[model samples]
Every structure is written in C-alpha cells, then in structure tokens.
Target: EDKVVQSPLSLVVHEGDTVTLNCSYEVTNFRSLLWYKQEKKAPTFLFMLTSSGIEKKSGRLSSILDKKELFSILNITATQTGDSAIYLCAVVPSGSARQLTFGSGTQLTVLP
Candidate 1:
C-alpha cells in the first residue's frame, strides 16, 4: 500500500518566523506529489510536484520535490497568524482514478 509520512506533527510559531515542513512517501507507480493547506474548512492547493529538484513558490510559501529520496518539503517564510493551518501532502498514483493518498499532515499554529 502507498504511504506518506510528515515530520513534526505539530508546530508553534510567531509572526515573521520561518517554518519548514517535511513529507516522505512510498507509492507504486507514482505520478506526483501535491501539497495543500487546510484552514477551518476545505484544503487549498499549494503545489504539485512531478519532477525532482524543482521548487514551486508563491508569496511566502515554497515547496520542492526530491523524487530520488521520495520526499518533499514545504517552507513558509515570514509567517503570520493567518498562516496557521494543517499542511497536507498527498501522492497521486499513475492510472488511478484521481484519488489522493494523503499524509497525516502537520498542524502549524502561529501565535500573535
């Protein structure tokens, strides 16, 4: 079965701090890895990594994939309280029905 593991299950930080979240996975016939940020409701897409060593960034958020290591990392710089949320990592298998196998996720709390 495919599996994903995220490090530091939870974190506490203040505004303007930088945080790094890690995710590793093992899947058969892997297609890609996706990152999502879940707030109070639904999860919002962050990045989709298919190629190794390619970093995707937007504003204070950035993510990179290491296909060779079967892992990925999400970095949030100069964080704000609004950045607090559950960060999820999911894997897509080739020829699957677009179902995503997600990690337990990292809960980040940014204090004021």
Candidate 2:
C-alpha cells in the first residue's frame, strides 16, 4: 500500500528557533510529492518537489525534494508562533486529483 508518514508527531519550539519537519513515503507509480501547512482552515499549499537539489522557499519557510530517498523535509528559520501549524505530506499519484495519500502530519508549536 502506498502511504506517507511523518515523524516526531509534535515539536515544541521557542521563537527564533529553526525547525525541520520530515515526511517519508512508499508508493507505486508515484507522480509527485507535496507539502502543506494547516492552521484553523484547511492546509495551505507550501511546496511540491519533483527533483532534488532544487528547493522552494518563501521567507522563513523552505523545502527540498529527494526522490532518491522517497521523502522530503520542510525547514523554518527563526520560527514564530504564527508558524505553528500542522505540516502535511501528501503523494500526488500518477493521475491528477486522483486523491492524495496523506500523512497525519507533524504538529509544530512555537512558543513566544
């Protein structure tokens, strides 16, 4: 069965701390890997990595794709309380909107 899983179920960080969220997966005929950040509303898109070395970044958040290891990592620099959210990792299958295999996600709580 194809699936994605994240480790360190939860993390507590102080303001200004840098944190990393991990996502691992096993799949068949996989198409792409996507990451999302969830607060109160549904998760907002973060990154989609298809190739390695190429990292997508916006301000304090960044991510890298590693198709070799079948996983990806999200990094936040100088974390803020607002950065607290559930980080989700999903697998975009061979077909579009075919439904993604998602991991429960890693909850990040940044203390002020």
**Per-residue alpha-carbon lDDT of model 2 for 12-63, expressed as tens digits?**
9999999999999999878888999999979999988887879999999999
Query: All models: lDDT?
Result: 0.95, 0.91
Best by lDDT: 1
Instruction: Kindly report the root-mean-square deviation of model 1 from the true structure over all alpha carbons.
Output: 0.8
How many backbone collisions does model 2 have? Answer: 0
Candidate 1: how many backbone clashes?
0
Instruction: Give the TM-score (vs. native) of candidate 1.
Output: 0.97
TM-score of each: 0.97, 0.94
Model 2, position 66: C-alpha lDDT score: 85
Instruction: Please report the candidate that would top TM-score against the real structure.
Output: 1
**Model 1: ten consecutive residues of lowest lDDT:** 91-100
Angstrom error at residue 66, model 1 = 0.3
Cα error of candidate 1 at position 10, Å: 0.3
Give me the runs in candidate 2 sitting further than 4 Å from their true place: none
In terms of lDDT, model 1 sits at: 0.95
